[model samples]
Each structure stands twice: as structure tokens, then as C-alpha cells.
Target chain A: MDEPLLRIVDVWKSYEDLQVLKGVSFELAERDVKVIFGPSGSGKSTLLRCINMLNPPDSGEIYLRGDNITAPNVDLNAIRTRIGMVFQHFNLFAHLKAIDNVSIGLRRVKGLEKQEARRKALEALNRVRLAEWADHYPAQLSGGQQQRVGIARALAMEPDVILFDEPTSALDPELIGEVLQAMLDIAKAGTTMVVVTHEMGFARAVASEMIFLDDGVVIERGTPEHFSVSPKSKRVKRFLNQLDVLYGSHEKLLKLSEEEEGK
Target chain B: MLFQTELEFIGMGIVNSIIIFPISIYIMRWYSKKKDMPHIQLWDTSLKTAYKVSLVWLMVNILIGILFNTFAKNITIYFLIQYYVYMIIDLFIGTIVVKSIYKKELGESFMFVFIIQVILFGIGLIIGFITVLLLGYIFPEVSDVFFFVLEFGLFFTLLITASSLLIGFAIGISLAIMRVYGGKELHWLSSGYEKLFRGIPLLVLIFIFAFGFPGLFWYLESLDRLLASVIMALGLRSGAYQSQIFRGAILSVNPGQMEAARSVGMNKIQAFRHVVLPQALRLAVPGWSNEYAVVIKDSSFASAIGTFEMTFIAYIWGLRSVELFTLSMGVVAVLYFLFTFPVTRLFGERQTKKLKKLGMGGG
Candidate 1:
């Protein structure tokens, strides 16, 4: 009700002839957990990237708190420091150890002293349960551990909100749970998050709202229960059904449906 | 020739095989390990490989034997017998190495070990010749010729090589960074410099620096004009080549590294300085070592302008007599080998291993 923590108003982006995000808008309040998912080439990842202006929208307004981030002459580095990003590839600095990867943003962008930055980085790593891996390089760490380090990197920045662009998509199936669990823990700790993911279990467990984006526009937006109970659009139903067949529906959705059959 | 009679030659052949077999096998083992040859059963495929390699060796040895016999008189019989003995021992050693240590399938192991044995023999023959040259057992007429070239030539050759490589590498990396990440104008400027320098031959460039620049600039006249000109020509030319090496190295680094740095809220310059450049430099080391060797060889070109490097010194002393000229040139060739070979092996191999450990440079 009181000013949403972040606001996106009709963001439109394209690459040459291809329109990736068209008039996509969203709002997130404090401590909210939002999940965006759709079929491949649905512009879910592009919309998330547009939040931090990693890929700036062609025409749109993105506001962080009350400041218009999309406006010209805004200090992008400063704005980026406040809007953290976790990439699908877990792009940890190849040359640096886990601690350095986590602390680089703190020291460079936040202007924290080395010791202070390192101390905070370790704390963030501790949250992801990877504090012991501080000395290891990304090449030495497993996929799950590397992604956790990536999350720690963003968490150490203490940003206004974190954007996760398919954080577990690049991971092996077995490794996906640990990264999702880290995200869940962050959500429980009252962090504001906008995640683009295919993990239905994670969506059902923590997403306050689930959005289905198609053809660069939000097709459906509702509570997770609302989608499983009754999705308004046939397109949304078909897409979610395909995802369920491929990745399996969440445990709660199965139980909810079973209860409905009994009734 | 070391043994006089048939009986003595037979005894010496046995003795030589005993001594050389272990050394040959040791080298083969090292080569196999370095090649990462997988252990497998031995095969007979190496028979053909061995025969092919041995045939080449025999032809080369016979040719040399003919030359020696014709010129030195009656050395042919001894040389031919020695070559046959060495060839038999080499095949014997190759079979043993392939069977025991190489662990590759019989055919492939034989092929590999046989080829390696030929290389070993070639190296051994070269070492024997060089030792004879240095000990003055052969070419006693110009025994001091090597010392003469090395004493004076080493300084100028090193000066030109060191100066050019340093200057070239510095400008090279700057140009590489500009070409890779700079704006359109900067890219054009860097690329244009590369094309201009790379297009001109090193000798012509040296001439321009030596003659043209001195007339126009005048400051070059204060220095040793030839030495400064040689360094400038070689260095600027090397910069163009080294720039390509570094640019390729930079391009080889994963693009994700740059994206990661930028996503951390570092500006483009900050990201490049901290993230992309360090990895790119490591990747460039092996390529740059080749550049070092190139500059070393090109230092010989400075002789065209009479800067008195090893090649020029070889030329001056070589004019004394026909035989002395041949011996002097041979010594200078050895000296150049000594300059380039060890550094390439030590720097290039070790850097590759270290980079591999860091999971960089595709090593």
C-alpha cells in the first residue's frame, strides 16, 4: 500500500527486429517473493535483466524506491549496487576465490574497507552455508556451491532487492535443490526477490505471487494457489500443464488436487 | 672409427648399445608421459613406422658418410658400419620402450616409440657433432672461432633482443586493449598501426629508422644510430605481431568474466582492469614467448645494417678462409640455438602447466 519497494512501468525492450519485452510492468513490496516463469523464449530472463539495466529497456520506466532508475544521467553503478543480480551461469570471477568473489562488490561498489568487506562477505557465505569454501576458486567448487557463492556475492551487496534470472537452470538436477533451498532461506529471512525460474516446487513453497510471461508480456499474475485451482487463460493452463509433465507439479498442488477429487 | 678392427668394432657396438639403451628408454618414457599415452597392449604396427623412420635415418647417414669418405678419405667404411650398428640398436631400443613403458596398443606404441627413437638419434648425432666442434676434435682450424663470435656478439644480440621485445610487448598490449575494447576511432588507430608496421619488412623498417629517421628527427644522431635504429625497427615490428597474439589471447577468455565483473557494479574500465586484463595477460604468456624467439632471430637482421650481432660477426670472421668461414658459421648457428632453445622450453612449458592449474588459457 505504502510506496512499493520497486516499480516497473510498461518496460519495452527489443533486439534488432525481435521484441523481447513489450509493455511489461510489475511492482514488488518489501519482503515480497515473486516468481516469473513461462516457456522458453517467453522473455522471462530479459525482463529480469531489465530490472538492473544489465540489458536496458528500449522504452520504459523502472523506479527503485522512488528514484527513476531508467532516467538519463542516473549513476548506473550506484543503482546496480542497490539492485543485486544473480545470473543463471553463476558467473563467479574465475581468477578469484569464493571470498574475493563475494567481497568484490562490497569493497569496490559499496566503498567498504577490505577487512570490513571480507567480514561481510563471510557472513553472506555463512547464510548460504558455504563459509568454509571461502578459500576455494569457482573452478574448484561444485555447481551448487558456485551458485551459492553467486548468491552470497549479491547478498553481500545488501541491495534493495535481488533479481534471480533462472539461477538453477544451468545446474545439474541434483544440484538444483541446494540453490533453491538457499533462495528459500533468503525469502524466509524477509528479502525482496524477483526470480525467473522453472522450479515449480520452489514457486509453490515460497512465491507470494507467480507470473506467467508469454511473447514479452505478462499472461497471468496470481497467487500460486490461484493458478493450480483455476487459471483464467487457456494458454496459461496449457503452458503450466506442459511444465508439470516435464518437471513435475509441486507436492502441495498434488495434495490440493487430491483433496478436490475426494470432495 | 673409435675401434680399429672388426672384432673391436663388434665389442664396441655391444658396449655402446648397453650405454645408449637406458638413456633412450628414459627419454622415451618421458616423451610418452608428456604425451599422456594411455597404457594398452603392444601391436606390430610400429614395424612399418620403425622401418619408415629408419629408412630416412639410413639415407641421411649414408649421404653424410659419402660426403665424409669423399672428402676426408677412407672414413666411409667405418661410418657405414657404425650407422648399421646404431640403426639396429635403435630398433631394438624402440621395441623395448614400446613394449614396456609406453602402455599403448602394440601398433600405436611402436609407431610412437619408433618415431621418438629416430628423433633421439638425430639429437644424439647433433650433440656428438657439437661436442666435437667445441672440443676441437673436428674443425681444429677454427677452434677459437666460437669464442670470438660469442664474446662480442652476445652483448649486441642480447641488447637488440631485450630492447625490442620490451618495447614491442609494451606497445603490443596497449594496442591489443585498444583494438579489443576501444571506440571505433581507437580501434581504427590501433589496427592501422598494426597493419602499417606488420606490412613493412623488418629490414626495410630498420633501414628507415637507420637512415630516414636520423635525417628527419636529428635526435637519433646523438645515440648510436645503427643500434637505436635496429632496436626501433625490430621493436615496432614486434609490437604489431605481439598485438595480434595478445588480442587473440584476450578474445579467448570467457566473455562471462566481463559480464560478471560488470554485474558487480564496477564500471567498464574498472571491470576490464581488474577482471579481463589479468586473465588475458596469463593467456598471452606462451604466445609472447614465441614473440621473444622471433625477436631473437630477427636480431640477426640487424646485421644487414652492420650492427655487429652474431650473424655479422660470423660474416666478418668467416671471410678469413673457406674452411674457417664454414666453421665460424657453424659455431654462430650453435650460439643462436643456445640463445633461443632453453628459454622457449623453460618458459613455454612451465607457463602452460601453471595456466592449466588455474583453469585458464585452455592449457
Candidate 2:
């Protein structure tokens, strides 16, 4: 690919004694949807959090659009303005109404006027099909609706790349579809995205490339079909096998036969 | 003779009854409307009117007593009749005026009733004076020290209670801020201050500050014993309790709010101003009111310091006349109730409403 829109090189992060990410490396072209897949504790979420400095890597270089974000001289606020993050817990400001929550960063950080920021907020909410809930507080909305507002808030910043750290992980089973559908809409709009999720079907359907992580390292990175059909690393194979047992596979009989024989 | 005396008492009582009762009620009703009714305004107005009426009646009774001693030989029965009569008349007139205003289609014009009451009461006072003068000739010597104590004592106590509460609130809120946001050293200092003050009985705290502090401080030795000792002791002790009220309020603010504000490019001070302090201060109001009640009652500690605040003044004057002591204490008790009872009630109700809105109240 011509120069990648984003490149993460040998990124390493730890929290005290626990090393969560170990020399993780990745690259993304403009408008690519990269899905990171792994069992829980695989550091997929922490890696995504590191890209935007929400959890800055202890040692790594993350360049966005040719700027070295990991460099100490880079204005992190300015960098954050161009890189948006959606949290797993949907940490929307509890006291603010949906629209105000979306507009807050715009008005305060981007210097948008109240009316203009609200208009942009409405537009972002409309993109997520949550325009009707714009004036309602988070407490008044359902979990799915609140997640959508969170997405709207992230989108209002108009970042170059969106990072999602298990966006639907905290959502109810029935509510998961609504948040995923909103994410699918974002992907269709052609924004660059990096998502850490256990949702294999979404990975299979939407991701241009998939990275399988285990114990803080990327074990396999390939096309979704390649990973699904013929994962090279034994770790990837075993991880996918366990996921198959948990979710049950939709793959053709050949893969099932292999899985059963391996079991 | 008993029938004639009772009839004359009842007859003279009518005018006094009308003047006192209606003015009190009308003032209360008018006050209630301005303050959004059934809340602060209601209590403030009623208490204010009660104080005014008590003061005016005290002066009138004392004057009448003095005049009777000079001009009429037998004024005791007349004074007793006047006291009861004026009380009844004031109640009656207050009820009529309040009810009339309540029934009127005057929109917001009800406020004018306060001005009208003052004007009417002034005219009524002149009329009452003339009537009393004419009646004095017939009834003779009908006002006494008992009447003077009732009126003056009530007004004096109300003034003391209200001033103490206001001062307490101001000191309490400020000290609370100092306790909460005043740096690590200040926080420790304020915490110690709060514990020391709130831990000690309010009476002891007041006494020590009022009596002990002055005795200990050489510079203060030359100052007026009563003024210096009482103000310093009461104000300092109040600051300690107020600080606790504030600290609790500030802590109640969510830490998330401060983080959110900082993420939005606000500095620590701006974050506190915009997001944290406003919500914390609102939450602290009921607690602050409780501390205010303590302050009002605690002001009585000034009496031990030898300040001639209401309780002290009453005690000094009461010692000479036991009747005055009973009347003075009654007036002071009523004044204290007027100052604190309604505030506590109002804050309690508002706190319930706030809790309800926050989804923290009853199931």
C-alpha cells in the first residue's frame, strides 16, 4: 500500500507489574476497517487504547498521517482531536443531555459555538439513527441508545481514525445488534477504524484485515477468509477453535470436520 | 361591678384586637406570596411582623403605664384589658387583610398590601393613641412592666436570633471551602479546626472563646470585654462547624465531573467552578441549615461571654423583676422557634425534592 494512513511500530505498554502489550506492531491504509480478534486478556483492547494515547504505550512509535504521535513534542490534545476513541463502558457524561454530551468537546475543544456545535451534534446523532434521543439524558435512554450517543460524541470530533475498545462488550445481548449496526454504518461511511471485538461475524463481514492476538503479541494478521479458513499460527487455530465451541461455527463442513478431528 | 369591668375590658379589647391580629396575618400572607409561598418568604414575613407588633406594643404599653402613673391612679385593669384587646384586634385585622388579598383578582398587585398595611397601621396607631388617651381618663393606670417585657423582649430576641443565623451561614460556608480546597496543609488545619470546634460542646466552645480567649490574649485585654470576647468566640466557633458542613458538601461532588472538565481543556479552578462546586454547594444546603440552627442557639453562649445580646439583656433586666424574666424567656423561646424551625423544615422539604430528582429518594 502507498504510505499507510496509520502505523504502529513495536509498541509496548505495561501497568506496573502487568505487561498488557508487548511490542505490538500494525499498519492501516486510509479508509481501512481493521478488526483485532483474540480471547480476553489478549491485549487487543489495550493496543487499541494505546494508538490514541488514551493508554499511551511505554515504548512505541505511533504515526498518524505521517506525524509521530508517540514523540514527546507532539501536542497530545491536537493529536487526540484527530483520533477519536469509543470506550467499552460508554462513559458519556452522566449529567449532560445526549446532544450536550456530543457537543461538549466540540464547543470546548474545537471552539464551536453552542448553536453550531449542537447542529453538528444533531448531525452526528442522526448518522447513528439516534437524533430523536438527542435532548434526553443518558439515564433516560436505553443501553443501546446511550452507546449510540457515545458513538455520536466520538464522531462529532471528526477524527481521522476511530478506535473502538470492545464497543458492544458491556451491552446486553439483545442490545448488541443495535450498536453493531451503528458501527456497520460508520464503516460504510468509509472512515478509518480499528476495533477490538470478540464478534467474529462482524470481523468476517466488515474487516479488511484481521489481527489475532495472544498474550500481548500479534499471532496472526491476514485476510478474514485466510484467518477463518487457514490460520497459520497454532495459537490462532486453537483460539478460533475455542471460539467455535463457544459460538458454534457457520463454516462449511470441511472446517467442521477439521475442528472435530482436532478436538 | 364584675359585669361592668368585664364588659369594659371586652369593649376596649376590640380595637387592640383588630389592630394586632390582621396586621400579623396580612403580613404573613403577603410574605408567603412573594417568597413562592409555604417556604422562606412565609416564615420571614410572619416573624418580621410578629417582631414589629411586639416592639410597637411594648413601647405603647410602657408609655401607657408611665402616663397612667402620672395621670390615672387605677390603670392596672385597663392595661391588662388593652394587652388582650390589642392582641385579638391584631389577629383579626391580619386575617381579614390576608384573606382579602388572597381573594383579590389583582394579579401581582398583592405586594402593595404590605405598603398599605404599614400606612393603615400608622394611621391606626394614631387613632389608637387618641382612643387610649380618652380611655385613660375613664379607666386610669392600665399598662405595666409586664406589657413592656412582652413587647420589647420579643423584638430584641428576634433581632438577635436572625443576626446570629446570618453570620453563622456566612462563616460556615466560607470555612467549609477553606477546609475542602485549601491545600494539604490547610485541609489538615481545617479538619483539625472542625473537629475541635464540633467536638467540644457549642456552649463550652462559646464560653472559652468568649471568656477564656480574652483573658489569655494580652492585646485583647485592653478591648471591651463583652464585645471582643463574645464576637471572637462565637465567630471562631461557628467557623469550625461551618467548615465541616462545607467539606462534606464538596466531597459529595463526583470526581468524574472534575475529570471530565479537565479533559475539556479547563484548568483545575475552572473545572471546580463550572462542574464540581456548583453541584456540591447545592447538595450541602440542608446540612448547612442544620449548622445554622446550631449557630442561632449557640449565640446564646454569648450571654456567658457577657454580651448583652437578647438572652443576656433579658437576664440582666429580668433579675430585677421576676415577671419580666418569665415574659422575656417566653419571647426569646418564640423568637428562636421563629428563626430556626421554619428554615429546618424548608431545607428538609427541598432536600427531599432534590433527592427525588436524583433518583436517590424513596422507592
Candidate 3:
């Protein structure tokens, strides 16, 4: 029971000629919030995909509550139900409306009755402030609204951990705020999360532990304050320097990135 | 029965069918209007619509019949003229009415109604043929009762095509899934089936089932089994072509949809059923409609093996007057065109409209 809720042990995955993730490993504790940020092509998204075995690691193991999930004998679907994921592209089922998108897994995977599943779906949408748009299709909504519906869909599963892979990367600038705000509320509610994003403000505010992933490896891990002030790696310091310009609005993150780069 | 000869009976059938057409339409229309019979009423709507189309078509056929009767002297020429005339009306008038019946936004749930009507019409035609045959039997058998054979032969064309299309659709969808998502072995199996069925001619395949296979299998020698064999062979061959249509539709669904479904904890099969196939099937409607047109065309070859569909009956009728064979064939080609063109265009139009709502109308 004292063990972390989710653990990835030396996971590695390569697609054809591209090695997406190289020997990445981490542990996520219950009720803890994590935000991973890195440059493009840094394997941040691949690591998140590997966590749910959507792109299963070519080697090594993933354990959920001490069960080896990467084993061939394990049911990937059952394991996935315990750990939900949100993609960069808000891939909602077009044929179904927003509510049914949230309720489908509830009916098919959870075996819930129609009314119960629908009620739960509406409740999940309510959390994202999308209950009013329940009957609308994904095409009818904006990018931010669609991403919020995506979060609600994952949240409806009530998984042990939810992974967000650049969830706001595809949203319009104005829409990113709403999606991030919904995510911030989820973090405040103490749900476990692993989010990959460049939104340093969200990370600074809600992240309990932040990690810099680069070259398919975890370059640095610390509190947002600790990472901002003094990241040990020169590469991480340099990346944080660029983030300094990205997060110029945040005085603390700017001062830290500047101070560390100056050092 | 009042006709002096078989040729006169042919003439009388046109007159009687024209008269019976409106009376049948009236009764069917009144029955459809009855309250509190939802199941019957549901079917009655399509049937009434069909009756209206047939009524218009019958009038046209009568006009052509009257024109031809002034020049006709034999049963063979009468049979060929009447068949060609009816087929033309069915293609033009029937197609338009059926298309109009489906003009509203149709949910996938209503697909069963469309399919059931085809099956029911096949059954209706058979029942009507049997009724005519019984009426003739109860009376005396005149030597020139060739009109009965002609009617049965014409109706049999529709029956075989309907059955083969239904079977081919089922087989084609399965083959498509196998090709798209199945493993290496299953993929090879489906590919092999498609290649084998599509490569050779439909006539060759039909002959294999009707004549070649029956020699090896004792049960296939039976008359019913022989009929089943012919239908199955046509359907199997059609399935190969149908598979390509389905595969194209399945591929048109974006790869991201599958990933989205998986991210939500649905397995491959559930994801396909929930996310992929529903969308793919809608997109496939145009292709599937073309497959139906092809089934009618290809199944006409079933006549070579004595399956007794349109092409074979046309050939036999043409043979009766050898000098007019070329003229008969030219008319048959026109008849084929009317039956296929309009209905397929309607399918493409409706599907395009539905797909436009989904924002995928360009392709």
C-alpha cells in the first residue's frame, strides 16, 4: 500500500528507424501531480503513450499497483481502464455526441446501465463545465471545448492515474486557458496526473514535482521552485532558459531561469 | 383463359396486369392507412410506394404492348417485347419512386427496413407467380401456356439478384474486416479469396458450382442444392468485388479515431464497432450501392448455368426468333441500362448529402 500507484521500470520503445523512448523510468505516487516538459522530439509524448501501453515499450516493464502490466498475459484493455490518457488531438468519436463520448466506455467496459452511465457522463462533463454541450458533437465545439470534453471522457473512467500528452498543444491560444483551468481544478482535487506541456505557469501553480525530459531521458526532477532556481544539468538549464522567454509573465519562473542561466 | 391461343394470352396478360395494377394499389394503400398496426404500416408504406411506381410503369408497359400487338404474330416476340418494356419502366419510374421514399435523413437503424423491403419484394414476386401458376392449373392447360414460363422466368431474375446481393454483402463485409485488421494468415486468406473470385469470369464460377462441383458432391446434384450452389457462387464472386468497396470505406476513417477509442479503454474490436465501422459504413454507402448494381449485372450470367435470370431468359426468347436475335439483344442492353443507372445515382446523392453533414463531402 505504501508503494507508488504507478511505476515504469526502464521502459524503452523504438519505431522503425526512430527510437522514441530510450530507457525512461519513473514512479508516480497517489494524489501527486507531475508535469513533464521538454523540447520538441524529446520523447515526452512517447513516454506518456508508453505509460498506457498505447505504444507499448519494446522492452522493460510497467507496473500498476505492483502488477506487471507490460506482460503479454495481461489484458491491456483492463489495464488501460485503470489508467486513462488524453491525446494532443482531442480524438472524440464524431458519430456520438459529447455525452455519449464520455459514457461509451462506462457502458461497454464498466457494464453500467444506460441511465447510470449517462448520469455519470453528464456529471463528468459538468466538472469541465461542458454539461450544457452534452448533446453537441465534437465538430460543433471549439478546440478548447473539445479538449475539455476529452478530459471529461478520461475523468469519467475514474482511473487510478490519467496521462495528458500535450493536451493543450493543439488548442488555440484563447482556448488553452479554459482547458488548463479545468486541468488545474483536477490537480487541486488531488487526482494523480502526468501532463506534458509547455505551459510553465500551469506547471508552476499545480505541479508538486516537475521533470525535464530530453533525448528520451529524464534530465532533471525536482519541485517547480527547485527546478527553476537550480537545475543540475547544463542542457536542462539551457532549456529552462528558453522557457524563461516562454513564461516571461511569471516573475518567479523568469527570475529563477535567469538566475540559473546566469550562474 | 378466354384467349384463343398462347399468343393471345400474352396479350391478355398485359391488359389484365394493367387492370389489376390499380386495384392492387388501392387495396394496399387502404390497408396501409389502417390505424394501430405499426409493423404492418411501416412495411405498407414502402409497398404502397412500390405499387404507385408499378402502376405508372404498368401504364407505360401497356402503351408499349398496344404498339407492339399491332405488329406481333408469335409468342416469342411478345415475350421479349413485354419483358423489355416492364424492365425499362422499373428502371426509370421504379428507381425514382424508391429514391424518393428514402429522401429523408436515414439513420443506420432504418437500414434494416431498406434491406427487408428487397427481401419482401422478392417474396411477393414469388407468391404472385405461384398464384398465377395455381390459377392456370385449376383451369385447363392450353398448349400455348408459354406466358406462364415467361412470367416465372422474368421474376426469377429479380429473386436471384436479391438473394445474391444479400449474401454477397454479408460475405464482403467479413472479408473486408479480415483484410483490414486480421493477422497475416487471415489477410492472406481474404486476399486469396478476392483474387480467386474476381480474376475469373462470373460465368466460369457459376458453372463450377452448377455443373463442375455437383459431379464431385452427391448432395449438390439435387435440384434445390443446384439452385443454392448457383446463388452461392454468384454471391461469393460478388463478395470479392464488394470487399474492395468496403475496404476503401474502412480506410477513409482516420487512423486517429482508432487511437482515440483505445485511449478511452476500448479494445480493438469495441473501438472498431463503436468508432470506426459506423463512420466507415456511412462513407461506404456510395460504394455499396455500386456493388448492388454490379450484383444484378453479374448475376445475370447465372442464366448460362440454367439459374433462369434476365440474360438467360432474354437469350432463350431471342433464340425463338433467330432472325430478330440482334434486335432483341440491342433492346436487352438498353433494358439493363435503365435498371442500373437511376437507383445508383440516388444512392450516391443521398450518401453525399449525409457525408456533407459530417464535413467529409469532398471525396
Candidate 4:
């Protein structure tokens, strides 16, 4: 097998006395889409942040393309450039317009010239269908449009993988679909992603693998089909059912997954 | 001319004592009333009110008489002796009157008399100061003094205020960053510096910089020592205050701002410079203007060290006589107000509107 594009080994993290992640391990091959879901405090977001060292894991190692990012003296900023992040709050730089927001990293970190960065930023905006909203400040944009700009910001970096930490969680219900659609387009383009969300329909449509985290440990890991059809753990089945009821009908979720699989 | 000066002094002294006597007693009565003292009948007996009035009257006359003899030209030793004899007589009567009126012990009545004397002097100076300004308008000779103060004094004041504000703002930004984002040692050091400077009076600091340091290190002496010391003292004090302003503005920014910047692959310093600092500065504009006003007023303290700023110039020209002193102070006060008001309005109101337009949060 070709070496996994990213690997997490025995990751453990704690905040003071409370352990947030316990011996969680995972791997992602190139162009893989992993969907992570659990109760709010299950450390799914923590794990994603650890991958980029935003919140460094207390004990364990993370490797990106076989480089040990967890080791001392590793350049974390350089590592972060290759691992994009989309926050739940859609943390767009409030001072900059959408175009500048997407272009800042490209110009600052990537050493791209002004025109080149602008062109690439526009291209990324177009990808997220936010090209016309490029000149608007984050405050002027709707919640959905802001999230799309956030995604474009991450995508412009051409990172190996993007981590979406509940991207649609802060959006109004009507606005969630547009952002999810943008994420779907990115997934279809074969960009590697790890998304932490409870949107069962989106998970059903694009997840290459599904992970269920509880009490800071992975309770279930399987193919998308394994989760919908015959998850081994009873807790996994119960969680999917709950998520399905909250997000949509199980039949509808299954139908979406089947149609995407066929495609 | 010498006889006229003495008579003028005596006349002004009588007028001041008459005006101050009633007001001081009324103020003292109001204060004692606030302290929940029992309503003593102040006017029931003719003797007590007469005593209170005369006690204040005699004190002001004696004090102003001595000032006149010392400051006015060609006042003979005979008049000085006459004022002393009256002061001794007044002191004897003042204690008896205060004790009988307030029904207080000897020490407390002495304190009461002292308090009334200070109030009389303060009020007397203010009235004299304004009278000189009025006299300047009527008399052509006095306006020359006003223009002299405006020309020579205004320049040094502007120099002190501007340079100190610049130095302070720069140091303030550095110190604020250290207090906010720096690690254990830096945070401690910056905070300690702020506490030490803010706690020490600016006058004491000026003295330290001007005399103490140069005395300890002879090589530190320079021709511009007084001016430099004034700037150093004012700048360092302003820096302590401005640091707090900037620190507050920095913290007012959403923490998510720094996190977002870092997530974009910029290091902490880059993130602070690009994302946090701009927003913090915009929020700091109002506070920065307030610091400007405070530093401008504080520039007056430079007069103590004899930098030729307006107040120092005021003192020099003022020393020719008491009337000149009053006129010089009035001019200095007006000039300081003029320097501070317009700039504060420009920054405080207009920049705030601009910040609002940009959608930057916080006042």
C-alpha cells in the first residue's frame, strides 16, 4: 500500500486534569474524506487541532507525509501551512475583504506575488461560488458566505489536507446547505479532508470512512456502508439513528449515500 | 509711586478679606452640617457671627499685608513691623474666636483656622489672577506681558508635550505588548515598571532625573539637562498610562483573531503585527487622545525643573510683582487649554467615527 498521506499514533491530550483524547490513532491516504462525529466534547475537534498542532497533544505523534510533526524543533508554522483549518466560528480576518482574506496566506506564507495571489484567491473564491462576494467584508456577508470564504481561504493554500471543525454548526439552518454544497464540491475535486460534523446527509454522501468518538476514545471505525447497514457497536447504531432523526430520515440519508456511491 | 503701591496693596488686601470672610464661613458651616453636626444657632447671638466674621477678616488682612510688603517695591521696614504686630494680635484673637464658635479643643480650632487661611489664600490667588487678565484688557502695558508669555512660553510647552507624547506612545505600545503577550519575566518586568512609574509623582521623578542622576553620575550632565529631565519624566509617566490603554485595547480584540492568524501559518509575532495590532490600535484611539490631554496638563510640572515652558515663563515674569504673577498664570492656563481641547476633539470623536465605519468593535 502506498504510504498514508497522514498518520496519528497513540495520540493523548488533556486539559489540566481532564483527559480530552486517549490513545486515538487514525490514518488518511491521499484524497480520503473522513467524517468524525460524536457528542460535543468527545475530542473530535481536539484531535483535528492536534494534527496541525493548534492544540498539541500531550503524548503521541502525528506525521504528515512521513514527517514527525510532534517532535521537538519541528517547524509548526511550516507544518500548519500544509494543513488548513476551518473553524466552527468562521474566523475570517474582520479587517479584510473576502478576496484579501483568502489571499493573505498565499501572499504572506507562500511568497506569491500580488497579482498571482489575487488570481489564485479569485480562483479559490470561484471554486466555493463566492467570486462575486470577494469585495465584501466578513461582517457584510451572511453566515453561509463567510464560511465559504473560510473554505476558500484554506483551499487557496493548496494544503495536503483541510480540517473542518463543525463548519456548518454556527450557521442558520437555511444557510447550512450552501456551505455543505461547497464542501461537497471540494470533496468531489478529490481534496483530502477530515470533517467533524453531525450533518448525517453530508456524511452519508461524501465520507470515505466514518469514525465514532466517545469519552476521548474511538468507539467505532468503518466504511460508510458499515455504519448505515451494520455497525458492530450498538452505541454506533444508536448514535447514527439519533443523528439521522435530528438531521433527516434514515431512508433519505441512505438514499443520498447510495446515489453518491453509484456516481 | 511707592506710596501708591503700598496703598494699592492695602486696598486690595481689604477687598480680598471682605470677599473671602463670608464665603469661607459659609463653606465651613455647610461642611460641618454635612458631617451631621447638631444645628447650632449661628445667628441667634450677635457676638458669635461678629466673632467668626472678624476672625476671618483679621487673618486674610495680615497674610496679604505681609505678601504686599515682601513683593511690592520700596515698602519700608516700619510698615513690615506694623503688619507683624497686627498678625500677632490677629493670632491671639483668631484662636479665641474659633474655639468659642466651634466649641472645639485648642488643637482642632488651630486646624480650623489653618484650613480657613488656606481657603482664603487659594480664593485670593484665583481672584487676583482673573483681575490681572481684566486689567490687561483695559491697560495696554499689561498686554505686552500676555504676548510675551504666548510667544516664548508656548513654544517650549508645545515641544515638551509633543516630544513626550511621541516617546510615550512608542514605549507604551512596546510595554503593552510585553504585558499582554510576553512570557513570565517580560510580563513581570513591564508591569513592575508601570507600577513604579505610575506610583511616583511626576515632580519627584523630574527631580530624580534632573538632579539625582546627574549628581550620582557627573558624566550624565548636559546643557539641556532640565529640559531633557522634564521630557524623560513626562514621557515615562505617560508610557505607564498609555500601556494600560493599549493593553486594554489589545485584550478587547477577539482572541479568535490571534488564533485565526496563527492557523494561517503566520508565527505569533507576525499574527500580532498583522491581525491583533491594527485592531488594537483603532480601539486605542480614544484612550490615546485621553493620554494626550493628561500629558499636556502634566507638561506644566516641567516649570518646577525650570524648563522655559509656559508655566516656567509664567513664574519668571510673575515674580516682578503679585499682579504679574496672576496675569502670567492666567495666560498659561488658557494656552494649555487651547493646546489640549482641539486635538482631543479631533482624535476622540472623528477617529471613533472612522472606527465605527470600519466596523471595529469597542469604544
For this target, which candidate reaches the highest lDDT against the unseen true structure?
Answer: 4
**TM-scores for every candidate against the unseen true structure:** 0.74, 0.62, 0.71, 0.71
Residue runs of model 1 more than 4 Å from their true location after superposition: A249-263, B1-143, B215-223, B361-363
* TM-score for chain A in each prediction: 0.93, 0.92, 0.92, 0.93
lDDT of 1 by residue, B1-363 (tens): 542333222222322233343355545546656777565123224433443344344333333433433465343465645656756564665455545644435554554655566566566555544754676775565556765665456556766887899899899999999999899999999999999998888889988988776764455554468888899899999999999999998898898788777777899888888888888888888888888888998899988888877899888898978887887888888877866775576568878887886677773
Candidate 2: tens digits of C-alpha lDDT, residues B273-294 = 6556666666767777787677
lDDT of 1 at A43: 94
Candidate 4 chain B, run of 10 with poorest lDDT: B42-51
Top model number, DockQ: 3
Worst 10-residue stretch by lDDT in candidate 3 chain B? B140-149
Instruction: State residue A188's C-alpha deviation in candidate 4, in Å.
Output: 1.4
lDDT of 4 at A139: 81
**Model 3 per-residue lDDT tens digits across residues A1-263:** 77789888898888899887888888889888899998999999888888888888999888899999999899889889998889898888877899999999999889999999999999999999999999988878999999999999999999999999999999778999999999999888888999999888899898989988888888889998988777899998888777676656577666767999999
Model 1 lDDT on a 0 to 1 scale: 0.79
**Candidate 1 local lDDT, A1-263, one digit each (tens):** 47789999999999999999889998999999999999889899889878888888999899899899999999998888888889998888887899999998888777899899999999999999999999998888999999999999999989889999999999899999999999999999999999999888888899999999999999999998998889999999988786775677477567767988999
| Candidate chain B TM-scores, in order | 0.61, 0.54, 0.59, 0.59
lDDT of 4 by residue, B1-363 (tens): 222345444444444454455455566666666776554443222233444545465555545554654576765647635654654466456656666766645553454454555457557756865776777678755565655665456555656877898889998999999999899999999999899999999999999998888754345446467888889889989999999999999998888888888888999988888888988988899889989899888888988877877788778988999987887788778767766786688679977887776667764
DockQ of candidate 1 against the true complex: 0.43
DockQ of each: 0.43, 0.13, 0.49, 0.37
Ranking by DockQ: 3, 1, 4, 2
lDDT of 3 at A175: 96
Alpha-carbon runs more than 4 Å astray in model 3: A16-18, A228-232, A243-263, B1-154, B215-227, B315-335, B359-362
* Candidate 4 Cα RMSD after full superposition onto the native fold (Å): 20.8
TM-score order of candidates, top first: 1, 3, 4, 2
Worst 10 residues of 1 chain B by lDDT: B7-16
